[model samples]
Target: MPSPAPWLYWALLSALFAALTAIFAKVGVKGVDSDLATLIRTVVVLLPLSAFVWLAGKWSNPTALSSKALIFLGLSGLATGASWICYFRALKLGEASKVAPVDKLSLVLIAFFAVVFLGERPAGREWLGIALISVGVIVMATKR
Candidate 1:
């Protein structure tokens, strides 16, 4: 059997990470406040990421980044932090199976933002996937 492409492998790994994140977050947040839970999770992530950053020598590459790129990267980090906080809070309050699908609604948000700000248009299949995701989220959000 042939090896998967690098991007394909990374994508698959990312999906697995996302699945584990929800399960672990749910377990970690059990009987704990979401704010504190997120803080603990941040520490958990930071320790390993800091080690990887040091190992990768990115800590010494400050001169390689343009000022604008650095600013945008910082902003992106802030945005991601905010999103993670909200995601953990939602996971703590809701079922992981439901919250995971709802959180995935971000794909639709990303698609809309891409069209508006990036001038990128989605192909027909992409639109269909977005629509199905939207419908699924709506269905999941509805309580019996």
Candidate 2:
């Protein structure tokens, strides 16, 4: 088969890392306050990410971007922080299998939000995939 797009490769890698994050965070949060654990994780991420930004020389480029890009990036950072805080809390209290699926409900929300806020029109197949993801999350998150 022909190779998939480059973005698909990155997306698959992202999913793999995210799965590992749930497992690792679940173990890391044991006997620790979830918010504090999230803070520690943030520091862990920052240390390496900072080094990467410096090594890649992308740090100064942020200033070259428009103020609108900076503002949106700042907002995205805040949202990511909030998501991590809640995710750690959920992992602390619930099984990773359960929490992970519910956490992924964000994908369905993202599809809808993109259409509404970003004016991105998904194709019919994409909408079907989104609907299937919504249903899978609901099924997985529901208690037996």
Model 2 RMSD in Å is: 1.2
Provide the overall lDDT of each model, using Cα atoms, as 2-decimal numbers: 0.91, 0.95
For residues 1-144, what per-residue lDDT tens digits would candidate 1 score against the true structure? Answer: 998788998898999999999999989889999988888888999999999999988786776889999998999989989989999899888999888988989989999999999999999999999999999999988756
Stretches of candidate 1 off by over 4 Å are 1-5
User: How large an RMSD does model 1 have?
Assistant: 2.2
What ranges in model 2 sit over 4 Å off? none
lDDT of 1 at 27: 90
